[model samples]
Target: MFRSSRGLYSHIPCPVLPRCRLPHCLFNHGQQHQTKQPRQAVPQRQISNSASTAGSSVYAGKGRVSSSLLIGQSEINEHVSLAFKGSAKRDAPATESTVPSATPTKRARQQVSVPLESKRSADAAANFTAAEDEAKDSAVVYILPVKPHPPALHSQRLQLATALAKALRDNKLSTTPNNAASTKELEIASRTTSATYANTMKQHIISLGKRGKSVEKINAKKTNEIPSERILEYIPQLVHKEWQLEENKYLTALPSQNEIEEARAAVASGYETCDRCTRHFKVGAEGQSECVHHWGKPYRVKGSDKKFSCCGEMEGMTAGCRTSPRHVFRITHYPRLAVMIPFRQATATGNNFPSAVALDCEMGYTTLGSELIRLTILEFPSNNVLYDSLVKPIGEVIDLNTQYSGVTSVEDPGIPTFDATMNTVLAKYIGAQTILIGHGLENDLAVMRLYHKKVIDTSILFPLDNPGLTSRGYKRSLKSLAFSMLQRDIQGTSRSSTVTRSTTEGVISNEGASCASTLPPSVVAPDALKLEGHDSIEDAKAAADLVALRVKFMLALEDQKRAGATTELKIAT
Candidate 1:
């Protein structure tokens, strides 16, 4: 289960106000907001959208989510903005009545705040007229100028110095006659005293003009809640120790079915990595059968340090309180994989060898391991379905893995059996030259007993940089990717109780399910599989589209770089 962070890093930096040294800051007041990483190419920023969804497999980008500790989710960030136009005169304080609770008359006259873009006033600032411009509609605060103003400046140090300086300059100069010698000498002495006062005033003015940034920095540290930016800054180092690294020596980037089979026979015999707990165990171990896990992804609640599991439990409070009848293991070793009845690689007969392909599968817990229940494949670029079907699994049916998968039944008389379907249906569309696409297909490929050399995994393509959450690492959900990249929402929504049939779009199969959606607050039995299912066809198309979008972004970035270089060369000449 997972969601991506649009908080901290997603908010646009405050607009520069040229000389914004006001007692009351118009921009980020108390928070220590940092600008996002500067992109060399503007479109790279758009990658944030496409990051979750990009990849290719005839059917790829599984949105099947389980109690995965490697995939993380967090609250979407909301931008906060406060702006004021500089309409005050060169220098004069407002009357005491003008300010809500100013201590003295001097403070009232000097503190002037012009509202930012008010239709009611003809002189509103045009800088932030549009609410949704770059700031994404930073919470618009509409404070009327006629209303009583709150005490603006909080830093006592600046206030005291400012008031003292104003008093010295405004009052008439008076000297004691006892201190002066001759009239001429007194005049020279008076001039020297005046310069000293002028210099001191200048120094205080400079310090006060710095917009209280130093004071704000101190205030930020005292804040009780952690800032979103601080959370983002620490994300990279938060990768879970159990999470597999991209360069893990235990497995190759692309291991073939044969290699995995050999490993199963030699070293990792009867061993499996549980999809729920991420613990390795012998398939038949006594204690291994029971799995205590959350059926949903973990998320960080906004404004609170408290983290929560999607299943409605405080994160880290317990080691997955919900117990499953069977500790379903994700098939990584090939020998233990379920053999699916093929609809036949009927499309393989065609001479056309697709360059790109996306794939997705649905699965159920079986005696042998997780078995493939449904498979969907789509051709790249065109998004034509090369193959799609429901298959009978190899083991005795246990739980259908439906809480995350959303698949309710295979008992419909229309469901096809091994004998009814033709074999080699997948071999037809995917060939040596074809590049397979999916999101986190490692587990899926093992179920298919395939270790394709040419593969484009969305999890690898657009990894979640944040690893601070318990359920996150490099991999993210297809739903997150689709929403981020394609700007379209998919999965669960399309597959309702009325639509569970031979196939659907955005569904995760038994093999490598990657659903990000979570179960409801209530827990359901494993056998129930009551959750809404996903569509492989929908995810497949998204994977292909994700890859295509990435390619286009890269090309555009290169073109922009070239244009910039050429312009610079002309100027140098």
Candidate 2:
């Protein structure tokens, strides 16, 4: 049966299965019989090289089977049927093998054999072309160039003045009019008339000369005709009855002891005072309060045997151990003679006068040393001119100090006398309750011989304290305060021009005198000369403006405090 099966299978022309051996011939026959035909073409190159050997073996085995098989009709019939089926399968594989062999494998071989460099070059070229196409399709942009503006034309007079100054400085000309040629040259270059130019030049020269000299020399020269000491007997008596009447009419009443004590108490309570050191401590709480007085310590030099005493008086042989209290007081603590001055409130009358006023005074050298030459007062809120006047000195005129006083010539018929300025100009605007504000107000008040209780001094407001030094009353300049706090530039313009002209006009108008008697020079001239001195009116207005700014800042701070307090109260509730 096995021989018959092998003979039948070999004659059936099955695919060369060399792996099928006689030891497992039955399994091989069964597998071959069960195998399905392939659906696709099997290329001749894809077939194994062992196929030919297997095919030869199969044919040899078939020959053996044919030779060994017993001759019978049934067996012949079975072999014929099986050979027919095998021929059908062999025909299909033959057709497929022939189809692949006819065509060349050139396309497949080329795909596998391409060089790496050629592929990389092709890929790079494609990428670059694509990038170029994208760039061409994008939009173009252009930037426009900017043109610069032309320079502006400034003041011609200022330019000429500057040139003249430069020329004088270069020539090393002594600022005194003693050099007539230099003065004339400067005047001509400055484009000013001889008379006007001469006066300005002479003043400038004298100022420069005086600055170079000692204070004693300058004072001696200014007061050459007058005595160094106060000559009370030499002072001329008030011959005019109007002056006496004016003084009597404008005299302010003194404050009582009760008001003074109340003011002191208020200051002690720490209102409006610098509490930088004491603010952290509970003022009156036990074990928390700090001393208000400034203390001084004894010091000994590096190699000295003796020790320096404290500021306080020395007790026995040793230096005083206790700290000394300074006699410092705020402006608010000062007692005012005027009663019931309104605090930043307008008066009941329709006069529209401000509650506070800022004052500035200019002094000229006289037999009594420096005396008030001009006084200017400005209303606080409105900054309106309350009082502006040129006052004749109480004693014999020594020097006008026009370089600083801004009083070029004090011969105006409309200018008020010292008595009239105090009574009519100042008294008309200021009340007992009015708060007086200024820089270095004590000096101004002393020169004016006026006693004002409610005062606001910028010097006191912003003290220039040098903690290392023992000096306590160091005051800051009004210019510095205005520049730093108010962001304003003041006292730059010459006071002689603006102040003198305005003051003369104001005095004339106040006294109802003819305008002709106090007419100012060309308005343009004063504007041009504004570079020359300090204007009392301008100074007063500047001080007032500073105070107003301070008031606004204080109000803003108060508002913030109130808002914070209200928020805290709401949370507490």
Candidate 3:
């Protein structure tokens, strides 16, 4: 193997033979080679490049040799032989011969035939080399080293040649003065100016390749002319000037105070006197006469002289009487009024159609000092069902029994409370401005702490005639009113069980004893809750509908009374 300077190794030229030297191995043939010189090993260690061992053949000098050597071992078996090619005079036998014993005479005989053959081959090899040298000499030509150019000749050769060529050109009397001037100008231009020298050599080299010399004359004074960028610096100011010009063309004129006042008065009169009939108009009423009217024109008129004159003379104004010729006309303004409205009617916030809304409350009821829990309020006037749930009390108690006017609870432990379900019930049915009609809603509002004024209570409408009956005397329970008006009982199952003291205790015991511990309390007598979910939306609707129904009935009865009581001509019977 051969290694080159680039750290690459040539492939092994041939497969391993027994007597061949390994790249770096200790053993060869039957002996281990020893070197007397102390030298660093090329690879620091000897490695066997091939796996061949005893009996493996090593081809050397036109014959095969066998290896039976071990690394670093002294014992060597001498079976070495010499092989030689045949000469023109005579040929030796080709068969290999092995000496039976190691002896000095036999070794001498084995080596003696090779020296005579080698002397003859040396003479033949010298004759071959002489012929090769003679042929090589015949193919070659000799070259000499180049001579250096003269210093002055090398330095100015280009300039001298250019000037000499120009002078050699033939001149005639017909030559224009412009040509001579141009040549003189080019000579002066060749002298470097500060402007030309300011640019770098590389920049000039690149530019010279792309473009010939510029025709525009360069002056030393204008080396840094950046006119394009200078113009860019003032672009914003120029744009602003253009914008001001355009803005002035479309500027809006502002309305004066007097014009604004006149506009307001016109609007006021428009509402008061109908545009179709110019007279004071009442809602839900018929007009006496139709009149032509103006909605008023918009203008930037000076002074508030919005009135126009009629061509005819004024009735009250005469020559002697001192009155202005212009007659004064009065304009009336209509006031927006509030009236009793049904829950189904939309509020004055001007949402035309009515909508259902939910209500809720937080109140204290259970145990003397228990925390106030949320009370449920549900109303759907369109559906006519009210659901009010009583929450089992659980936060800071701010009031006692009846302190929060309208909460009632069930004795059953498993029933879900108002606090748990009120929000769900309210969001499902009610919205902002729902008119929740209840009796003495002040108490409900106090417990709820809600501040909506859309609510209307029947107790406020029905004040006592005796003057002694305020809330305490005339306040009616929903159940009592329902019973009186509809002649049907509307009972809450939890009401009796939650009533005070002995009555509540007895009622709970009776409910518990019915199952006799054989079943759960609910199995014997299931809770008879009318509105089972304790939802606020259902309760608010029921309450509002109850009031609306009563109002409609009362209005019908009054109308019947007026019809019956009216005096008419009596016919003779």
lDDT top scorer? 1
Q: Which ten residues in a row have the lowest lDDT in candidate 1?
A: 69-78
Whole-model lDDT per candidate = 0.44, 0.42, 0.31
Q: Any runs in candidate 1 off by more than 4 Å, and if so which? A: 1-292, 302-310, 316-323, 333-351, 412-422, 466-473, 492-531, 558-573
Write the residue-wise lDDT of candidate 2 on 1-573 in tens digits: 254444544445335464443432433354554565343534443233212221111121112112111121232223333432333234323444343332336543222112211232233233333443222211111110001110111132233333434333333232211122222332333344434644564565455444433322323233323331222111112011232212223223444678766765654543332222223332223443323432233455567543434344332343234321211111322252112121221123334444567789987755443577777776665555555667776555645655566566565565667776666644466665566778877667656767555566666445443312312334567878878866766666433222222444333121221122333221111211223457676577667666655444434444555878999999999
Candidate 3 ranges with C-alpha deviation above 4 Å:
1-363, 366-426, 471-480, 489-546, 554-573
Q: Which stretches of model 2 miss by more than 4 angstroms? A: 1-354, 468-470, 493-531, 569-573
TM-score of each: 0.43, 0.35, 0.24
Q: Provide the global lDDT of candidate 3 against the true structure.
A: 0.31
Error of 3 at 266 (Å): 54
lDDT of 3 by residue, 79-158 (tens): 11111122211333222242211222434333323342343323323332344222211111111001111112211322
Candidate order by lDDT, decreasing, is 1, 2, 3
Q: Which residue pairs come into collision in candidate 2?
A: 175-205, 176-205, 336-453, 341-433, 494-530, 494-533, 495-533
> At residue 216, what lDDT does model 2 achieve?
21
